[model samples]
Target: MRRDIGGVVRNSLLAGAALLAGCAGTVNAPYPPIRADLSPAALARGATIFHASCEACHRGGDAETVSGAPLRELPSYMGRFHASNLTSHPTAGIGSATDAELARAIRYAVSRDGRLMVMPSYGMGDADLAAVLGFMRSGHPLFAPDSRPAPRSEFSFIGGMGFRVITGNEPVERPASGIPVPPKAATREYGRYMAHDVYDCASCHTDGYSPRKTEGDDVFAGGMAFVDPEGRKVHSSNITFHETGLAHWTLEDFTRAVRDGIAPDGSVLRSPMPRFRGLDAVEAQALYDYLRSVPARDNEVKGARPRLTATSVRPAWVAATGAETTVQGTTVGAPPEGSATAPGHGPQQNNVASTTSQGPAGGTATAARPPSPGNASDGDGVTAPASPAAAQGSSVNTAAAPARKPRPAAPKVDAPKLFVQLGCASCHGPGARYQDRLAGVANRSEAELVRWVRNPEQFLPGTPMPTYAELIDEPTARALVRWVKAGGPASLSSTSR
Candidate 1:
């Protein structure tokens, strides 16, 4: 009837020490060392990875001048989880952490002092890992010393106990040797690598990120739960190409949704889903290929997305080619506000409303820079300045971000093209179930129509029609609205083609 109190305490201490040892084991050989890359090229690649993956949390729309702000302050059952300072500042940032310590923190999900920090387990290859770590230490101005004060992560007692039980099984093993990156292609193999390894999409998409998920099974079927910084719990979408998932989402649709955070049905993605507008066309298509290749299960994630705080105002972060990022002070370039697509550029993909496309060009559709979201844009993602001036044309006052050149502009979105580009025709087009969707458009006032184009959610709270805020400016929306009001061009097929 008596408890072995001393023995229990001794055993608890031993267990804790063992777990801490496992957490710190990632710094040794076989796991790529932090000393591998500090060259400009390596740092650049690291910057790209950070922008595409880490920026959603770390950058959180903060301009470069703002001392690294406490990005997210999540209140979960696990306790207060604050996004830590990643800058080079000695105390308030990672400057005090050794390279090995940072690597352990990032890949092993263990802090320097060896406590659990609920970060996604990274499976980055040797080269990629080296680059990212190198960038963190490369003295880049964006990551320059920022002594921003931020709250430290503190886990609840229950949460800490749960983490010990759940993650106590040593983390997934790092590669014994460098895991080379797959070739960049739309092939299922590369796509699979990109989805799971590069983007770590599976980390959130897989329900609870269950460790024993079967590849090509329901792992990518979604339902992984997340609590936004505001404490709103939302389930990740079932992205497999199943009936309840993307269904017939074209590659283009997938791209638009991910890059711009707009859904095909016009619903905007919520916080925690960074519009990876930074992904280039090929990279995006690779993800699409991977998703389509996976097994699809029916798991509908139904709920209103929690509103965002630090997203939407995305300043550039090691820019790739999403519509919202900037390079140095330049916008990567868009047309003047409310202006037509610039002369050399085709049509601005940013537009009034709709979803994505993976048309006849195969999954190789030209990458479209998203139109910067207007301040009034809806949803849980973006709140870019309304003016094209902030992010259009040859000059912009963007944050200090460096990058490879922007991708070529998307093809024009004239009335006929626009009609199909936004997936608008899919519902109202000839074969759709609702050709009458625009039946009364001719009677609506131009202002009302413009509003509809810019923000369909205002009219229909859960409409699948997304806003053109990140794709087109007001004028283009007005033009499209006028075109829709006029019954669309007679020559155009009601079909999206």
Candidate 2:
């Protein structure tokens, strides 16, 4: 009886493993071609929805700036479960996506075969889903034509090992289905769907699993980190409603920072957060709205580093100098006595190597020397002219002659009007006492204003101020800095008048 029972359990385990393998392999099925011709208005609405929802992870405008995977290039980038391009291209674009397929992908997170999909089922309302389909069929160029392989299973090894251990049987082999479906959509009730579903903003901006539970109100408090190619860590700020978030920022200030990479304090933000140089006025506004609506939390993150000083030089610089000494071994002459290293340039040289290496006046060696006049012969025996005019022309041609397309002018954004549209005044203006306090802070400098805008928790940790890290990019941050330094509405109006 005991042996019989053990055999039965083994068989049951094998059956379960087989079932899981089947589920994993057949997740993605071919989508049916879109049949209905969507109207222009529908397409326009879809575009707006896409900007608010999908753009964050996909394209984020034509700047090619990407925080998540690019949906436009999905057909080419995603390995197995490739997202079809939504452009009018003949072969791979979503011009062929059926309304049914679009609906299935959005609301149910299922493919045409009733299989689960890998997409996040976050913010897709019925209207927004329909709008996204319309935009997909709107005949716009979403991506270039390219074939993409399906994504490989990340859990295959675990499944195989588990099958071996439990059932004493080989794991079933099958093609992996990359489709993923959530039990329910988080943003479906709201009209905004694309940002939540396709872009999957909550995956990073909010803590995993129960984001609401972790962040009751603080939406973006800026503590996420990304490692660069050089292995330096870059963190994402928290965008929440606590005093540490972007509670003090204005809408225009938020827009400029995202589009331009300029901080609220007029400082440049580093790369990886690409500048949204290609976004038009309408797209920017929609994104702004979606971000404003995200629930704010109260997470107080550390402030940015204080200004760099001589003592604050990165360890990499020190290492490089030390390495040079060991390898070159003083072949590079030391600096002359009493000569100090220039501020921006590295250490000074002690002795001049050649007559042409004469030091500049004021005991500083001219770091870079002007090219020689007239023609000269090279060590390789090639004769070259040293005409400064020709050199200058070549430099200009190299530097300035790229055939770059002209960027469109940014639309003028009115902070006061936007504040009203987004109902910011409900908590910030006359009805609330918050306006009085903000008004009193008007005389602060741009830096001071930025400190308050970036995070209010430093001054008042318990106060309610949403961090705008997700919503407000660098440029928009700077604009808020300008506005705050100018004293919000009163200063703005005075300048306008």
Candidate 3:
């Protein structure tokens, strides 16, 4: 017999309630101490880390994936635990969280009560964690106003379910080493490092960027999507060499877009692409250097459209009715000429025997007929050749769906070529004021660098940084992480193993 996995799990949990009786003991652990005066640099780093890592599941109040829940406006029904709103709301937010508590949550995924938190713990380092804490302490509110019901004890079930789904009994862990620091110098190697690892420029922009299929071209031509809590969908845009891409965008334009979510047109990019607003001058310049060196692809993609209604509510019978409607020459009202018995024929001769009987009035039935040799119209008005071979072939063709065409390749660009086409050197030049700042940070670990690159807001709460998460993906983030952790050098390629 087939077993229902979810039902079985639910039943087992209910049966083992005694084992989980005291799981809620740590629900009211004391908040950590707060440091109100965090430096700009530290806040900037924190912001980046938050975007690259935290925002994947917490942006715009909703987690990007289904299992993840909304962070903002969390219903009290979810009190088993919620990703506390990171904004500076003192009464119910992370504004009062101590740096140590923040660090524990980030790197260790552990709450003050020593219980595991269900946050993703990838690419975090000591300095980076501290920077995030400093940034959070810097007093910036990212959420809009919304009141939810007060949390309750029963909500712990939600936390338990989340733990089962997201944590899977895993213990909290941290990065093995201290955060690496970058040097003060302008090097091609460093530029590549910042682009590939720190900022994760290649993640969502490249097609087939997985470790197994990393050879495809089309760098920076975006096509990524995220689902919101209410089931809305958002897509990443193309940033390539094509005219419709970011071809005309200046480095400043790109920078502003990444850090602020403000497009060149002055529009706010929607959720999941968190506003950076936290990057410092040095980190921004480093990102600029890397973007300049990337090869450009010309792939153009359509912007996002509204999501479809929930599948559950859609009419199930509509599909069957539609399929029947599309069969050529078939009609419910008409019957075929030869199949209809003459008026004088008896009831037995008049009724074409159906293989499956239909219920009286509301009954259902299946109708089958012996093979015919000549082209003929069925009583249902569907014109089919009576020949068995032809009918079989037609049925097969209808059943075997047509194949789809392969998607076109994305554009590609070499490092130096991209620098020239995009005019990156205008702000990131050697000896330039901005260049000196980026040079100082060429050696930060990939995780730290990516934090800065994706969004700077987590660190510098009110600073001006742009979000690059739209232009990158997880794989590219990993690649950049390797490059940054290895000292932000081109020769230090780190695409997994």
Candidate 4:
């Protein structure tokens, strides 16, 4: 009887083991299918959605960014992360994945292998999700065929646990069917969809992910800064239709700025401000309408640094001479030896950058105050004039001096600082180990440099470099071009390597 009992127990254990093995084999099988519409209209809609949402990261052209995981292995975070090429190429792409598998990946961030994916769920509408699937099946492939499996993530055990805890495997519920996006008319409603859902403009423009917060009305207030490859700091402009925001920008101005990269004043926009290839005039108009409709905030944004001019020298002179006097309309003292200025060209009247409230007419223009003698003596750099005697007998070259011919205004921009601020040095300067140093760029002509910055794609089609046609004014762009032509950050060093 005891021998019979042992045999039964052994058989039970073997049967349990076999069941577990069978369950393990199903881990990579396609998940249950979700209803997906694959009509031509859906595919077309998907193409536009992909361009606005996924192409920026997954298009396998420009260097991959961290925000959108590249569909192919590319440089990121001192290493590399990759997303599968969602194309019809066998072995190298997701052509082999079943509709069920693709749907699961999009809906729940669950891969075919049952591992959690890092792709963010953008709360896609049901039609949008279906459209994306259709697009993957029929759209043109971006990368060449390769059979290697997408690399496994190097996430730590703790990280895996945290991700599982926070983002559970529950699939996102699809919106009710047939609720497609409204017509692409230049209406405020469509504009809202394009801005908040498709382009994610608020993601970059606002201070952090405030859109997801309860106090999310701060969207488009614009406090974000993008450090360019050169180390230039590019602050996002406030798009709110307020005095401190886009109060001066008309719909046409916004359209031109986004599409042509030409600002209202005809300045060049800095890099990382990519031109949306497929964002058409209609879409741009719609976006503009939506921006106008949003709540206006009075957040003042610091845009590109003011371009260097003759007037830019006043603050430095005041600090250096340390003595103030009313020497007529001239700079109180000679610039310290080896300064960039010529003999008599003193700080002009409008040397101090200031903004005055002229109601809606001025539109919050940036204006500078001319450094005055009384204000100079008061140390605030602005005040009513003091007696001429107070100005004449000052320590910086006292007594009546000969009226020297005005020297040419010194270049006020520090090339190194400008190089970093313009983000040129970050990608092309001394520290850019992965890229070629810009020492040779100093050889390009000013016109060529300006042209390149204004529109690099015109010269090199499909190039990853961005255009600065709207982010920088002519003078600032000229200064930067001159610096690049003069060997950039390395020019400051005594020795060249």
Q: Name the best candidate (by TM-score).
A: 1
Model 4 lDDT per residue over 1-497, tens place? 99999999988767655543332232232343445557989877776666545654544434321112333221132123466555455665676788777767765556677765555444455667778777766644433344555554443333333333443334344432333566778888888876765566775677642224313878888776655444556677778887777766767567756665544443435545545545677898899888888899877777642232323221211222323211111222222233332222233311321233231111222233334434332222214465676667655654588874332222233446545533455456554632353555656776676667656655643334544443332333456677666655665432211
RMSDs, each prediction?
Answer: 16.7, 22.3, 28.0, 15.3
Candidate 1, residue 400: the lDDT equals 78
Q: For this target, which candidate reaches the highest lDDT against the unseen true structure?
A: 1
Alpha-carbon shift of residue 402 in model 1 (angstroms): 46
Candidate 3 residue lDDT tens string, 1-497: 14688888878888545334434334323332333227787776766665554544443322221122344323344353345455544444454556667655654455655665534333333555567666556544443322332232243565455444433344433344464535534544554444443444555455431321113565666665444333455455666535546656656555666665655443335444544454455656666665555566655566621111222121111022112110011111112223332222222311222334332222233333433445564332234565676657554455567774322111111223222212222223343223344554546654565556544444443332344333322223334444334433333222210
TM-scores, all models, native as reference = 0.58, 0.39, 0.38, 0.50
Runs in model 3 deviating more than 4 A are 1-69, 72-82, 85-101, 108-125, 135-176, 184-223, 228-231, 238-248, 265-267, 280-282, 291-497
* Per-residue lDDT value at 376 in model 3: 60
Give candidate 4's whole-model lDDT: 0.51
Give me the overall lDDT of model 2. 0.40
User: Candidate 1 vs candidate 2: which has greater lDDT?
Assistant: 1
Which lDDT value does model 4 have at 385?
64
Q: Candidate 3 versus the native: TM-score?
A: 0.38
lDDT of 1 at 448: 81
